[model samples]
Every structure is written in C-alpha cells, then in structure tokens.
Target: MTGARPRNRKELLAAAAAGLFARDGFHNVGVGDVAAAGGVTASALYRHFQNKQDVLGHVLLTGVDELADRLRAAVSGLADDPGRRLDPLLLAAAEVSVERRELTALWRWQGRHMREADQKDLRTRVGSLLTDWLAGLRALRPGLDPGQTQLLCFATLSVFGSVGDHRATPGAGFAELLARLARAVVGVDLPTARPSSDQWRTRVAPPPSRREELLTAATRLFREHGFHAVSVDDIGAATGIAGPSVYRHFAGKSELLLAASRRMADRLTLGLEDALATATDPADALGRLARSYVDTVLRSDDLIAVYTTELANLPERDGRELRAMQRGYVAEWVRLLRSVSPGLDEAEARVVVHAALTIVNDIPRTARFADRPGLAAELTALTGAVLDAGATQP
Candidate 1:
C-alpha cells in the first residue's frame, strides 16, 4: 500500500529505510521494501540511491546530521559557561532519542553493512560530536584526565542510546530522567590509576582441539566483520584449516553463528547464577551482577558484539530461543532492581537496567577506553550511580 507522497522523496526514503532497517535489520530489508514504505516506485528510489547499501549510508548520515545540528543549536552562545552547556546538550540528545528512536540501532548494528570508507565517515562525524562534548565536560571537571573524560562522554552517549533497545512506554519526565542519568554518568568519579592486580589481563589457556579453535576464530571474525560479510572460508583460514574443513566441526556459517551466540548466552547465564549464589541481599545481588557483567564483557567483548549484532543472521528458532534467554536475563535484573528500590515500577526498572547494561557493553568495546587501566572499577561505580539515581527518582 503506497502512502501519501512525501514533500522530499530522498528524506522520506531515508527515514522509511531507517525505521525498517532498524526494526527488521539491514540484511532482511530490500530496495523494494524501502521504496514501498516511502510511497515511491523502485525506479524513483534508484534515482536517489544507487542501492540498498547506499540508502543505508544516507539514513545513517542524515541521523548524524540531525544530531550535529541539534547539538550545535543546543549549545550555541554558551561556550563561556561550559558547565551550563551540558544540560541543554543532553536535553537536545534526549529529544533526538525520542524523535528518531531508530538512530541508535542504525548506528550500532546496521552500519556494519556499509563499506569501510562509509563507516569511517560515519565514525568521523560522530567523533566530532563526541569531541565537542568532551571539551565541555573537561571544562567543568578539570581534574579528569583525557581517558576519564572520553570514557564519560562515551558512557553519556550510551545512556541516551539505550532508549532504542526497548519498546516500553516511557514514564512521565522521560527526557528529564535520561538527562539526569547522563549527567550522573558525566559526574562519576573515575579512578586515577589502574588497579594493582588487573583481573582482565589474566587469560585462560585455549582449549586443545580443532573444533574449539574454529569456533573461537569464527566468533572473532563475525564480531570484526558482520555475519553476512564473513564466510566459512574466512573462518577456516583464521584457524589454519581449509574452508571445507570448517564443515567437519560445524555444518555451515549459520551453525557457527548459532554456536557463538549460545556460548555468549551461556556465559551470561553462568554470571547471573554466580551473582545470585553469592549475594546477601537484593542490593548486593545487583552490584554483583553489574560487576560480573563488566568482567564478562571485558573478557569476551568479541562474543558480546557478535551476540548482540548477529542475532538477525541466526536461524529463526535459534534466534527466538536466544532472545527469550536475553529477556529472562534482563528480567532477573529488573526483579533485583525493584527489590532494591520498591518505589520503581517494572517499566522504570527495566529502562534503568538497560541503560546501565548498555554502558557496560558499549564503553568497554570503545577502542581507546577498552585498554585503559581501572576501567572496570570506574564502570562499576558508574553502574551504581545509574541504579542509585533511577532508584531514587522522584
């Protein structure tokens, strides 16, 4: 069904494609689907974009443009008062979060489908926005080193990005709540030095087997390159085996993805069990959960990345099972959060839990911050702050 014709076909197509790609995933959406959604013919879409990938590039860049313009206007004429700038900046970001709910998802997962040059451009533009934020934050808190300031900026971005992860109806003061949480992240006190004993550095010995090596190699390749971009041959080469040899251990690339995804789910489940078994109370349980999560993500970020972004590539049944497992894990967090703070409703607790987890997942994957000393401790503190702020929301 063709809808009303848009005033500008290009913008309309990009917006339509963004929503579709964000909801259904890039690999699942086709050029005709985008054209129909935009209320235009396929030929007309071709006039604007060369292909589906081109449409995706336009959608992502357009979102980045909106963010840059809005943030620039939000902080206009407030350079002298750097402390006051963050409030309007964050508020503007919150507005984008609500208005363009698909943006974060597009940037996080779908952009991997783009060519490397396009991806680099996207990163550069987004990096400029983050640089602006880092300047403002550094001005307000001069004591923070470069790494700490950058980490805070990334965490703040994650707080706003978390909105796209769920479909729960926002409560009253939703934007205000997000801004407050971002502010809390910005104000977190980071550690000045790495811990004397770095647990993340301790590596386990690799299992001795061809199949295990193939699985390990496949997960990393899938993480580095999107699932559709990698192949059985690529996975085999990484393990010094022929492409056909990969099938001996796994039936196909799909099987490798399913195996890698299940590995991630199993690790998270084990972490939760560990957290539950050791905690004395709900609050303690939540803290242990957060710490366990940070540790898990830090140690196995490639697995986490593959699990999060490659869900669309899994077989239907496996996808459903993994997603259900994910929901159950999140439910446990929500349950513990509500127990810790009886005032928080289920929806509120869920949003808060997502924001906290997003920070943990996102910050450690960031290249600059990933290798920094004391990141785990700082992340745990930031997680606590997010939970504390959400728990006491008035």
Candidate 2:
C-alpha cells in the first residue's frame, strides 16, 4: 500500500496543541498529550517547541496573524468606501471564525497562560488589528465620536468571536447570519444620557468577615491574573492575612475559585428568575433579562470576568455544575427569544442570543468604555438591536 504524504511536523504539532488547549485548557493538557495527538514522540515535539507554553504561544500568535491577514484581504480595495467596506470585512471575519473555531477559545482564555512578553506581544498585534478596524469605522460613521466608534468596533468583533462560546451547529448561511448581526451592531445608536449616581450603586454588600474578605480578594486576583498565576499568599496579602490563614476559610485555592464561581452563578440565576417573574410578555422578558444582565456585569465586573474565563481552573465537578447552570441561563433567553419572534429557528435564536450576550460581556471589559457614561444603557440598546436583527431575518 502507498503511504500517505508526510506533513510538516511543526504544523501538525501546533494544530494538535491548539485543539487540545481549546478543548481541555492549558493547565489540564500536558506536553506528552500534545505529542501523542500529533503522532510524534515527546522528544520530537521538544525539538520544535521549548515547552507547552511555547506551543501555546505559537498557536495563538499564528491564529492572530491569520486573522490580520484575512482582514487585510477583506478590505484591500475598499479603502475609499469605508461604508461599503464593513460588509466584506464582516464576512471575512465570519469566514475565519468558522474556519478556525478553536482560535476564539485560545485567544480569549488561553492567552493568560503565556509568558508576560508573549502576552504583551499578542495584545499589541491584536490592537493593531483593532486600530485598522477603528479607522474604517470612523470613516463609516464620521458623526460618531471616537469613543462610540471604538465601542462599535469592539462589539462587532465580539459578535464574530462569540462562535467559540458554544457548539451549536447552524445550517447554511451561518457566516452570513453572523455578518448580518454584526451589521446591526455597527448601526446601533448608542445612548448619550449620563447615568445618575443612584444607577451606579452596587448590590453586593461589603465582606462581613475575614473569610468573605479572602473570597473577595481571591476573585479580584483571579480576574486580574490567571488563577494559576495567583497564589494563596497573594490572596492573603490582599486581605492582610497570612497564606496559611487562608486555609481556615477555604480548603485551598481551588475552593476559593469554586466559591467565587458559585457566587457569580447564583447571582445570574437570581437575575434570571427576577426577569421572568416580572415580565408581562416574551418581549418584555427579554428586555428585562438584557437590562438585568447588563446591570449584573456592571456591578460585578471582576467576578463576571473570573466566572467566565477561570472556569477551566476550577475542580472538574464544579466546572461541570457551573457550566450546566450557565447553559440553563442561556436556554431561558433562547426560549424567550423564540416566543417573542417565532420566525427565528432554534439555531438562529441561539446564535443571536450568544451574539448579544457577547456584546455585553466583551464591550465593558474594554478599558476606554468600561466606565463611560451611560454604558449600561448603550449596551442594552446594542444587545436589543442584535436580537432584533435575528427576529427580522428571513
């Protein structure tokens, strides 16, 4: 029998590592596993990569490079027609997102595992891509201020990137669907009224004891730094306690992560229940849920960040349970969306829901707009537009 043609070992190894890291997370996957997946010995893998971190950096940076190149090709000749350029730009983004679904997960969650220098380089490259998009957006909407334009750019990227958040396979026209949703995001009329002082009030009470203090500190640390990067001593220092003293309140770092994640999950569940209880109709319920979600994110941004990005660091059982809760929450939104617009199929509703949620989840994390006046209102409006785009689609 004729043997298959040999492939480049380095490319094979990177591909294998990307899939494993995206699926199992960086901390969970070992170098030997990556080597096995690539059909190579550990020694052979070591010849190409310094370590697993090196593999991860290669995977993530390569993905970024590919995206930047795709985007460049997307708008090659449309420089003068910034308004018309957005369609092709969005389509190109959607195409790449579908082709490399693993990239979204790697870029968002796995980058934190990289060394400091690599992480900075990654951000700079990604920022350059954003800057190019921002210039297009500025020309497309000359009336909008810099802040508004940047926010829209971020939201548009989030819509395309949201694909990695779920596994639901939509039928034909998936890329076009994402493009349409992104177009809606680009056209959103952000609200301008500054939020009143009372609107900024947080519902979370101050830590009532040393244990609560430690949990609070841990959540912040984990959000700012990856869970693996932070130590029990760091959490203790934040709360003025010794490293060993933290054990009295929580079993270990893992327990602290679980507790913090549980707190976030519980708050989201409660918000969902409240939205359901008071809504008079399906549309009303969705609107309520959107506003409630924005409020929750604004009030507990750090915890929300930790809850979403640090799940892979949690104990396996806790991760599964929290993931189920997350699914239930998303399912409720899908149900309400379908009821509101029976025209949308199940797959379409799920995709649109993810897009809207991603807009809210991602836009606020951008430092420029995180504390902007009336941000919550703008996010709520943008989210509504995303959902409306789905409802009106043929």
Candidate 3:
C-alpha cells in the first residue's frame, strides 16, 4: 500500500511555531512544543529555525511582509491618481484586519518583543511601505503636507489596526471609520486659544498625592473628558490646584493617561489574582476574571476610552512597560480561559481573549452611539456572559 504523502515539514513547523508564539508568547513557547505540534522532531524544527527567537524573527518578518504586500496591492492599481484609489485601499486594509486578525496579533506581539535593531529594520521596511502608501494617498488627496499626511497615516493605522474588520455595519469597519478618522485628522478644529507651556505649567500645581486624592481627582477628570482634551490645566482645575504646579507631582498628560488606564486594569488584575489565589474552586477563576475585566472597564467609560485611544501614544519606557503590563493584564484572563475550557486550545483561547479585550476597550465608541450608562452595563454583562459561555464550552 502506498503511504500517505508526508506533510511539508518546513511549512508545518513554521505554522505551528507561529500559532504557539501567538498563544503562549515569546518567552513561554518552546521549540519542542512547536515541533510536536507539527508532528515533527525537535531536530527537524531546529533544521528550519535555530531556536524560538528565530521562530519569532520568522513570524515577525512574515507578518510584516504580508502587510507590505497588501498595502502594495492596495495602491498598485492606483498607479497615478491616489484620491480615487484611496477608498479601496482603506477598505481593503480593513478587510485584511478582519480576516487576518491572528497574523495581526502576531505582528503586534512581535513589535512589542522587538529589540532596537529589529525595530530599526522593521521601521525601515514600514517606512518604505509608507512612502509608497503616501504616494498612493497623495494621488488620491492632493495638497497635504508631510506633517499632515504623516499624522493621518499614523492615526489611521493605529485605529484601523485595532478596529479593522470590527464594527457591526458597513460604516463600522476600517475604511469607513478610517474616513472619519482621516477627516478628523484633516478637518477637526484645533482650539484657536492654545495655552503656552508656561501658562499651562503655571496653571498646574503639585499634588500632595496620596492614593485617594490622586486617583479620585485624576479619574474624575480623565474619565469625564479625555486624555488630550483634559490637559494639565484640566487636571489642576479638577483638583482645585493651579495648573502648572501640577507638573511637580506628575510628569505630564501621557503619564496621567497610563496611570488612569493602569488603575482600572490593576483593580481587575488584583481582583482576578486574589480570586484565583483565594477561591477553593478551580472552575470559577475564568468567570471571576471575566467579571473583573468587565466591571473595571465599564466602571469608567473614560478609562476604557483612553486605554483604547490615547495610551498607544504615551512617552517611551513608560509606554513600552505599560504595554507589557497590558499584555499581562489580558494574559491572566487567557490563563483562566484555558483552565475553564478544555475544548479550546491555549492558542485559540488567546484569540478569544484578545477579541474580548478589544470589545472592552472599544466600549467608549459604543457608548457614543448608544446610551453610555445602559450600554456600558449591558456590554459588561454581555461580555461576562460570552466569556463565561466560552469558558464553559470550548
């Protein structure tokens, strides 16, 4: 009898490694596990990749290459006129995000893991792609400055990446939402009365920050308005302190943004950890985490808003660290999901957790269209129910 053809060892190993990396992360996933997943020997995997890091390098380059290709194809037909060509590209990019969220997640994970040299190389590749992307954009929309164009590009990619295929309707996906974001970038009215740094600095005051005074005041202002909307002036004004003086206590708005986001995430994290540590029943941890995440996000729609929109732009070291913290936040949830659902593989559970987190983060947008109070509660409920169901089932 003829034996069945052997699977392509290289292709199978790479795919398995990508899945494992996406699931367990760079530090946790082992090459042995990946090789096993591919039904191959560890040596066979080693033949293709030196180690797990090499697997990550491969995953990173592959994802970026796909994005570059999609972007290139998005504009190739435009050749000359970009304006008309742009609408399709935007829509197409969104479709890619929807269809390829796994790859998208891998890209995000790898970027977070990237070292300086890797980052530089990826940036160069992206830069080249963006130059071409811009050419396409310029053809479509003439007379935009490099600054303005760059802003549009930056904002579009950020919002689009998270939200890509999401949204309930035609108006919700990347292209549609992107058009609005693009319009906002190009058309939103900047306040004519801008405060000078000194003026802002003077208006701010140093806080005698104990936890309650800091978080209560900070949360109220940030949650009510937004990160950018509520500047140093607003924070000080909220605390009944002079604006500039506020800088003495907390560095700037970015820190404040991360602080507010972390506060919410921290509460949920602590709650989940405590629940896991204290609970007698192993079955309840996933439910507890789902409740923890939902409650924390809905408690302050403003916090979720900043978490989704502004935290991405925070200053360095702080930004990187906060992101890793955010990952930890979700990872705990994923860990619980894996425990509760035997049918769901670790990698599959991770994808579910990510989708749940995205929905939670995007709560602000949902509130904008619907009732903030009611929808917030409803969504939190819906999220808990869904995750619980996911946990109970597979």
Candidate 4:
C-alpha cells in the first residue's frame, strides 16, 4: 500500500513550535518537545532551525510580517489618502488576529525571548507599519501628536492581542467590536483635570497585614521591572523587610507571583459572580460586570498587569490553577453574552469578552488617556461598545 505523503518538515516545525510556545510559553517549552510535536527527531529539527530561539524568532517575526502585509493591502486602494486608511488598517489587523491565534499570542508574549538583533529587526518592521498608520492618523487628527498617535496605535493593537490570551473564535461581529474600540481609543479626547484637595490631604489608614504588604510590594515591583528581573531582595526592600523574611509569609519569589496572579483572578471571578447575581437581565448583568471589571482593574492595575504579563514565572502547578480561575471567570462572561444574544455560541462570546477585557487593560496604559476626567466612564463605555457590538448585526 502507498504511504501518506510526508509533511514539509520546516513548515511543520514552525507550526508545532508556535502552538507549544503559545501554550507553555517560550521559556517553558524545550527543543525536544517542539521536535516531538512536529513528529521529527531533534536532529531533524536542528537541520531546519539553528536553535529554539531561531524557531521563536520565526514565529514572532512571521506574525509581524503578516500584519505589515495586511496593512499594506488595507491601504492599497485609498488613492494616496493615508488619513482615510486608518479604519481599514485596523479592520485588517482584527482580521489577521482572528486568522492567526497562536502566532498572535507569540507576537504578544514571546518577543522578549528573542535575541537583541532579532528584536531590533522585528521592531524596525513593526515601527515601519506604525509609521504608515501614524501618517494616516496624523492627517486625520492633526491635533494629536506623534507620541499620542503611537500610544493610540498600541491601545488599538492590544484589543487584537487579546485573542492570543484565550481560545476565542472571533466572527464578523467580534471584528466589528474590535474596530469600534480601536477607533474610540485613537479618537476619544481626554478632558483636562487636576487632583482634588481631598487627594492632597494625607489620611493614614491602619497598616496592612504583612502578607498584604508583601503582596502589594511584589505586585508593584513585578509590574514595573517584570518577574525574572525583580528578586526576592527587591520585593523585601520595597516592603521594608529582610529578603529572607519574605519566606515567612511566602515560599519564594514564584509564590509571590502566584499570589499576585491568584489575587486578580479570584477578584474578577468573585466580582463577576456577584454582579451576575444582582442583575435583572442579560444586558444589566453585562453592564454591571463591565463596571465591576473597571473597578477591579483601576484598583488593582499593578496586580492585573503582573498576572497577565508575568505569570510565565510561576511554577507549573500554580500556573495551571491561576489559569483555571481565569478561564472560569471568562466562562461567566461567555454565558452572559450567550444569554443576551442567543445567536452567539460560546466561542464567539469568548472573543467578544476577551476583546472587551483587552480594551480595559490597555486604555489605562495609554499615557495620553492618563489623569483624564471620567476615566472609569470612558473605559466602561468602550467596553460596553464591544459587548453591544457583538449583540448587534455585523
């Protein structure tokens, strides 16, 4: 009997590596595992890739190339009118995000694993793509400076990046939601404001528990410096404790990271359940959920940041637990969305939920939107638009 045709080893390895890297993280997956996933020997994998880092560079840079290509296609028919191209460019971005889930995740989370030269090359290509986008944005919104345009571009892209974080099956409605949020992020004007006198007045509250203090300090340090770069000593220094004293409340730095991850996950999980319990209908439930999400994010931005960006440092068992909690929380949103729009399957609902979550996590990071009046309202409205878009026709 004739045997089945053999696969192209190079392409197969790339695909296998992308999935593994996206799931287990670049640092967590070994070369041998990638080769096995590709149904090849380690020697065969070596013949194709110089090393694991080479595979990583390919996975991430390929995604960037696809994005740049999509943007090029998006703007080709604009008749030399770059300003009018922003909308289509963003739409193209969302389309690619839907089409390439594992690659997108690698693009978002695995870049730091690349060598400096590879990172620079990727940055150059990405910068070129953004330069084209900025030209369009600048023409349309002359009041917005280059700095503001850059931040807005990132905020918009973050919505697409959410696809990598979950198993979301984005449809046309989900794409529309992403596009709408992208426009809002780039165009919304922040009102000028100052802190109230009450903010300036110092009122000391009771000291936190030692565990709370360590958790608080770790969250902040991890957010600013990343997990691997910040040491136990650094966390202790921030908390005004001896480096080894931290072991009294936690086992190690990984434990602190786990705590930070669990804190955000548990908070969202509980808050979402509470919100759902009190709502009159699907819409009300979603609205309450959105508001509560914004509150959790604003109050715990540092923790949220760590959980999303630094959980790769956690031990396998802890990571699995935190991820399960996160998935459970997301499932609640998926259920509520399904309730509101019976046409939406769990997959579509997941994409919309993640898109909304991305908007909340990202908009706050934009310096242009910082210290703006009605910050919470603005975030709620953007998130609501994503949810509402999914319910409406595409």
Q: Write the candidate numbers in order of decreasing lDDT.
A: 2, 1, 4, 3
Q: Model 3 off-target regions past 4 Å? A: 1-7, 77-79, 139-144, 163-394
Off by over 4 Å in 1: 1-7, 77-79, 204-207
Report the C-alpha lDDT of model 1 over 4-90, residue by residue, as the tens digit. 655688998888999899989888899999999988889999999999999998888877887788777665544457776778888
| CA lDDT of every candidate | 0.84, 0.86, 0.58, 0.76
Model 3 error, position 82 (Å): 2.2
Question: How many clashes (backbone N, Cα, C below 3 Å) per candidate?
Answer: 0, 0, 18, 0
TM-scores of the candidates in the order shown: 0.94, 0.94, 0.49, 0.78
Model 3 alpha-carbon miss at residue 356, Å: 16
Error of 1 at 54 (Å): 0.9
List, residue by residue over 239-272, the lDDT tens digit for candidate 3: 7778787777777776666677777667766777
lDDT for each residue of candidate 4 in 232-300, tens digit (9 for 90 to 100): 999899988889999999999888888788888888887888898999998899899998998788767
Per-residue alpha-carbon lDDT of candidate 2 for residues 317-357, written as tens digits (9 for 90 to 100)? 88999989988999999999999889788888899999999
| Alpha carbon deviation, residue 17, candidate 1 (Å) | 1.3
Local lDDT at 314 for model 3: 69
